[model samples]
Target: MDGNRVATLVGFAATLVVLAGLVWVVGIDDTLAALTTADPVALAAVAGIALCWLVSWGLALWTVLRALGSPVSPHIAILVFVAAVFSNNVTPFGQAGGEPLSALLISTAADTEYETGLAAIASVDTVHFLPSVGYAIVGFTFVAAGAVQLTRNLAFAAAAVAVLALGIPVAAVLGWQHRYRIEAAVIRGFTPVVTTVARVVPRWSPPSAASIEARIERFFAAIDRIATDRRTVIQTFGLSAFGWACLAASLWTSLYAVGAPVPAEVVLLVVPVGSIASVVPLPGGSGAIETVLVTLLVSTAPVSAPVATSAVLIHRVGSYLLPTLVGGGVATALGVDHAASPET
Candidate 1:
């Protein structure tokens, strides 16, 4: 294997070791005891919730592929997506590793270029991020309104701010597409910075003002095309919302399975916070996600320590394990040489 691949594997192994240590330190036996005591009906409910999440994610991927003007079969797309999930989960870089695997798999399966596959991936990610921001906005508003006591915990408030901060670029891109004049003003405001960066790069060639304007116009036009198509827009946003909701529900169901009666919204908030923490690029978010999730669950919900650990473990099994295994199997069966063909 190449150096990077070796490094990735090493990092992934290290992450697994850390997770093993965490489970041991936290008393895995106690966590298992909580799981053993969980109601059978609640366990079934958690399984159903996890199934819903997988279906929603598959649907979201299907919509994005369709939007890209590719007619790839949804079954194949979903299989590839699942495989990508596996790659991402076991790899060290979270979605970064997974996205490339996704792009490569889709490219190979559909006989497309890397760029085209990447474009499709990017489009889907845009759809996903928009709705996530919408949810975070709503969640933040609730917290701000004192409908939720999030502000009482500085860590939760900071997490909320971090999510909002991440959303700013996404909102800006959407705004630039929707409002041309405003976008132009913002771009103009950044011209000096852009120019300076261009100068610092030896091979950089700055675009002329007209060229820049043309590029911006094209970007806005593409966004308008996607945004104005009511069917496409609705399907994209609807699938994203459904996926995230199901993911949240899956966590809630896990807690229920552990006999913890936490509210669904609390689970929803915790899910996003954990996700945000996991963005730190560690394999499966390793220490970061577990720490944030345990902290949040302990502080925000009415649960014993064993229940909290079991709930997170169960949720991870559904969210990470099942999808990754499916994806990895699919990827193993597919030939890498198939990637060179153009998408039909």
Candidate 2:
């Protein structure tokens, strides 16, 4: 079986485990009652909007690929994006765990080099960050103006968003300024492995130190290709923001479905913070994401504990679980094999 296909199985099983855990933690009877009593149309809309979120982000990826000279169709871009989501969902630490595999799939599906694919996803992530903070800032502004209120958990969530909005940009700028030093450190770290491989496999010609350097250069070159294009950057950003909107809307709809309507700003605030909590080193950030979302909703919004839990569960079914299943199907249909040689 393909590595990704196997990951799909793992992802499916993990989602079940997470779902079961959620039911147990939140009380199965309450969860069942919430689901049974919820508005079917709004719950359906949650899943549909989640699909829209995927498509929007796929468009963003397509834009980046076209800028990087891939020129794949939007359909293929969505396939790659979904497969990438599967990779992320099945692994620990979310995107960080899945990126290398996702990069491989992107290169394979898009007919681009590995470094270019790597750069595409990395660039997408960098671009995606700002929009998240932008949404959070808008919500935080409402909080400041007395339009919205916060509990202890939500206050902390807002404070964290404030730091992320300020911190990420500064970190990015500093990292870019010192990129050469960082590159040198990376090269130095890899030198011993290259030497050992060369020593172990004398019959085969291993990649030279220059080849590694060139690969790094190409990675940056791909990022530069996208960055240098103002139009492409704008399109990517626009698509990303649209995707974020779809996600927030999905959550808001979920809350509404459960008859726990909250202010729109509450969704704006909670969605981004929930996303941030997704890096908690759990597969697809399963446990942590739900916890953060439920806490934030119950704290900052006019929702009961059980209703808040149900709403988050419903929202995640679309955002996390649905994507995992769909992406897995995509990986299987596409026959993506990350272990295969690029030339094959």
Candidate 3:
């Protein structure tokens, strides 16, 4: 096997091992019992929240794509967005793989240039980051009010919030101010990866570095055109904010289903913190997020270990399993899973 294949297999194995350890730690019997004992009404409520989340994200993607002049149907929007979610969570390189795969899927579906699709995807991501400032502020206010405790997990969460609060804005400013330089750097960074993907994936033509750079320049030009419009900016960010709110609400509903209800403030504070763990390379960030959630519950909330484990697992079912299953099915239907060959 080549190095990339070996590395991919190793990463997959490591993810499985971590997940197996998580199951063991949570206790298979206890976890199963907890799941079985959840309130049917609460589960339904959580499912509703998940459904809303799906719609909100779909709308956000649709808004960006339309603004970029590559509009897709709502049905296509949901499928591509969910498939991207599954890709990001399950694949190595975290969001790196997800965004490219999402753009590829969009290009395939909409008959648009890959560059145009990537620009639209980038717009969605940019809008999404704009809301982290608000989330961090709300979380910080709760911490200051002492409604949310400064437990180790919360501390980790707070640090993550700080990073998001600072990093994203600065990056945006820099990218905006130095669009051409940044675009060049971005193309430089992505070229090797995209080149590798082109080699491995059918229907892709490997391009010279100069051609890759030209494509990236076109991507940024497309993004800049969309970003310059005030209405597009407002609508995209508005939908993105609502999408994040749904994620927090989904977490709150999951906690309620296990009868370990916390205030909405607490949910907002911890959900983002736990979610930052998803950026880690582990599949679905299973081990890190479960640890973070368990710690957050035990130290910050009134829940016992058993209840915390159950609530987190329930949340994972809605947030991770349901979307992944649906997205995987969509990927199969779209022929995304079969797009690549073993040999470049």
RMSD of 2: 3.1
After TM-score superposition, what is the CA distance of residue 223 in candidate 3 from its true location, in Å? 1.5
Local accuracy of candidate 2 as per-residue lDDT tens digits, 1-344: 59856765675576567757766877888877887778999988998999899999998999999989887999889888998998888887788888997888888888679999999998997888889998998887775566354457856876889777987789888988888788888888897787888888868666767788889889988988888999989999999999999999999999899888888888888899888766866687787788888878877766777788898889989998899898989877666454454655
Model 3, residue pairs in steric clash? none
Candidate No. with top lDDT:
2
The lowest-lDDT stretch of 10 consecutive residues in candidate 1 is: 142-151
Candidate order by lDDT, highest to lowest? Answer: 2, 3, 1
Question: What does candidate 3 score on TM?
Answer: 0.84
lDDT of 1: 0.69
| Per-prediction backbone clash count | 5, 0, 0
Model 1: residues with Cα > 4 Å off, grouped in runs? 2-5, 137-154, 165-228, 336-344
TM-score winner between 1 and 3, please give it. Answer: 3
RMSD of each: 6.4, 3.1, 4.4
Candidate 1 residue-wise lDDT, 1-344, digit = tens: 59867877777777677667766777889878988887778767766777777677667767666765665787777776676677667666577656777777766766655555655565666677666666655554454454445435535745565655575576766765567677577578767777888989999887666666765665455455566677887897898788888877878888877778776656666776677655666765665676667767776666766778888878777787777677778887775445443556
lDDT of each: 0.69, 0.84, 0.75
TM-score list, all predictions:
0.75, 0.89, 0.84
Candidate 2: count of backbone clashes, pairs at least 3 residues apart or interchain: 0
Between candidates 1 and 3, the lDDT winner: 3
